[model samples]
Target: MPRIACLHTFDSNAAVFEEALRATGLAGVSLQHTVRADLLAAAEREGRLTSDIAEETVAVLRGLSAQADAVLLTCSTLGPAAEAAAPDSPVPVLRVDAALAAEAVKAGGRVVVLCAVETTVEPTRHLFEAAARATGAAVSVEVVPQAWAAFKAGDPERYRELVARAAGAAKAAGATRVALAQASMAGAAALLPETERPLTSPTVGLAAAVAASRG
Candidate 1:
């Protein structure tokens, strides 16, 4: 069994991400609330990540990887830090969006990165571009930054609606596929069943990636 150590910034994402792993038929999941929200908050406020903050996230990863075969980082804000830490980790440390980015590039030319948070937008776009480069795909990114408010207000219905509207806008902008940047946005993706464009979720991507890593 591949014991996945899921590192999360918010407690809210734990249940949803664990359920995603279960849906993938991999039950060996350990969720950890890395109380490093301050680093993310600072990163969001500064519009860039500093080494000290990234190191804080890496420190959390180091402490959690002792008994696990893989680590899944569910927060996009910490993605760059996760990637930076992977080289020194004892096991594979994966950003949840890794699979989603690869899938988006494989499926479409114009990839729209739909993010609820401002800080996550650039990291996600960079990941998609990296994936696109690997696939030799010419891709352009369109970012939609309008769902974080509903999320912060603790309104699920409005949150989903905002995300759904962003999805519609991405399709209208000629996006071949859309990738939700946050785990919280997965609920929004669920509510968008009638969406004409292909949408990707980190929850689904992370589960699939961890399952494959076990093989």
Candidate 2:
């Protein structure tokens, strides 16, 4: 079995990301999760996240690496730390947003990167811009800054409602797809109609990336 470690900035809720991975029914795959709200707090204070926290985060990854084949970062905020640690880490490391960002680019035209946390907007925008640039695709990012509070307050219903409203606005604004910037926003995608442009979530893409890295 190939073991995969998913790193997160939230204190818990890793299982939410793993569901789609397990749904694949690709037997003999082990999944592990590591949570560090400290990283998220640091990002909030620093105004941005980068290699600055690599020392501590890398140590965490190192510990997980001893027992896993690869590590996947599930938080957009600390994804850069994973990118920084990948070069020296004992195992392969990947930012979950990578695949989602690429998908955003492929979705074409304007991409709305929706997030509950206002601080996450810019970093997520940069991720999407980089992906769009890599594929020679021209795309613009739009932000929905109203839902984070609800998620933080433990009011998922209100959070989902805000996200759904954002999706409607995104459609009206000519967005080809709405990319849920935070992993937690993944649930918002489900609230939309199936025929909509489609809201892309990172869970499945991140899981697939980890599975592919096993080779």
Candidate 3:
């Protein structure tokens, strides 16, 4: 069994990814959660990530790494910090969004990345574009600020509603595919109308990352 450490945002709990892993029959793997309100709050304030926050996040991952075979940072805004933490880790470290971005580029070119948080959007866009470039695909990314607000306000129903609304706009914006940038937006994909468009979520990405790292 692989030991996996999941670093999450202050607003979320490990239950989100725990359910995803359970569904995958990967329950044998040890899963741990690390939550830091300060780091998450810092990201929310700056509308972008800072190296200091990245360093502080690394401290959390480092602690978890001591007991796990791999680490997965569940927050999209912390992707850069996650990447920075990897080289120092004893095991592999995966940014939750990177795997989804890779999958999105593989699934479609005109991809739309939707994030609930303002700080998460640009970082997610950068990761998606980098992944698309690697796949030789072109992408168009957009940030939906309102989506994050709904989720942060402790309303999952409103969050899903906003996600569907944003997905519709993404479709109109020439996005043949949509990638929900945060783990909180996972099931929101189901809200989209049936069409040629495909919706991607971080749940699958996190699962894949854990599997790969464990292997």
Give the top-scoring candidate (lDDT).
3
Off by over 4 Å in 2: none
Ranking by lDDT: 3, 1, 2
Candidate 2 residue-wise lDDT, 1-215, digit = tens: 77888888875458666775665666677778888888888877777764666567777876777777888888777767677778887778877777788877784576767776756777677788888876655555555665777777878888878887887778777777777777776766677777663554555555665666676
| TM-score for all models, in order of appearance | 0.87, 0.88, 0.89
TM-score ranking from best to worst? Answer: 3, 2, 1
Clashing residue pairs in candidate 1, if any? none
Q: Per-residue lDDT of 1-215 in model 3, one digit per residue for the tens?
A: 77777888854557777777766676577677777767878977876788888888888887788888888888888888878888888888888888788888985467777777778777887888888876667776666657767777788888887877888877787776777888877767677767833455446665766676657
- Preferred candidate (lDDT higher): 2 or 3: 3
Please report how far candidate 2 places residue 37 from its true position, in Å: 0.9
Greater-TM-score candidate between 1 and 2? 2
Top TM-score prediction, candidate number: 3
Model 2 residue 129 distance off true place after TM-score fit, in angstroms: 1.0
